[model samples]
Target: MEIKAIITGCTGMVGEGVLHECLQHPDVKEILVINRKPCGITHPKLKEIIHNNFYDLLPVATQLHGYNAGYFCLGVSSVGMKEDAYAHVTYDLTMEVANTLAALNPEMTFCYVSGSGTDSTGRGRSMWARVKGKTENGLLKLPFRAVFMFRPAYMHPTKGMQHTQKYYKTLSWMYPFFRKFFPQYVSTLAELGQAMINVTIYGYPKKVLEVKDIVAAAAITGK
Candidate 1:
């Protein structure tokens, strides 16, 4: 199945990596990126939108149509943020955008970038985990054709990408060791991006993907 995907968070590490793959993949014919600012990249298949507020996408709703897939990578860290503030960005904003997308394209395949320790039960002790879990649960209730939650732990940065996180670059050499010893928790950005595409094209048995599932999906060439 060919893909016309709507991607968010192109300025961040994961989003940038996914956008890179989408632009190069033959199966992906068109790409749309919605961000507050320009991502400073150009491609024949790419279209960008600069919308400051994601809390409401009504202003850009007309621009988003005929997209069968969505890659939601927009997120913020909870390290120093209060619960309300974190939820506003992580949960509230995401849901608002997702709800609009669901209404616009019910058949779209939705992929969310959730961390490794998300609690599906939403009863976990960690604040961020619980919030993420709640978000995941809410997303599953939507009417999209398929919904997938990716739980990646240690991600190796993709080379030649401008938005690769500095911390990831610092530990790039250790990825080989992590891949050899703790394979379950380690994955490359390339694999994660490809895995999402594969899952969207060819539905997987499991909806939630760990590192191993992601790697296996990336290996699949045909839908």
Candidate 2:
């Protein structure tokens, strides 16, 4: 199946990496990104819409039609963040956009880039994990074709990508060690993107995918 996907958070590391893969692949025929600012990349298959308010997508709802998939890569750090503030950005904001999309495109398969150790029960000790868990559960309740939650531990961003975040320099160096010692926790950005595309196109058994499952889906199938 040809993928015409709407990608969020393209200005960030994970989203940028995923957008790069989508542009390079043959199966992903089109991409639309809604960003607060320009993502600074271009392709014939790509079109971008700049909008600051993710909470209110009604203004751009017309442009969101005809897409078969959504890659929700937008996220913020919870360090030193309070519960209410974190929930507003992480949970409420995500739901605002997701609810609109699910209604507009009922057939759209939504893939969310959540981190590993996310709490499914919403009772985890970690604040961030609990919030992420709530977001995952909320999306599952949406009336879309499917909602696949991706729980990657640590990602090695694509080498030389201009948007690769500064903090990742520290993590990039540890990628090799993590891959060797803790293979399940380490996955490349490229694999994460491919796995998302594969799951949306052909579908997967699990609603929530971990690092190993993400790696396994990276391989493209002819049939």
Scored by lDDT, the top model is 2
For every model shown, what is its TM-score relative to the native structure? 0.98, 0.97
Model 2 agreement with the true structure over 57-98: per-residue lDDT tens digits = 999999999999999999999999999999999999999999
For candidate 2, the 10 contiguous residues with the lowest summed lDDT are: 214-223
- Which sections of candidate 2 miss by over 4 Å? 220-223
Estimate candidate 1's alpha-carbon lDDT, on a 0 to 1 scale: 0.92
Q: Tell how far residue 152 is off in model 1, in angstroms.
A: 0.7
- Please give the clash total of every predicted structure, in order: 0, 0
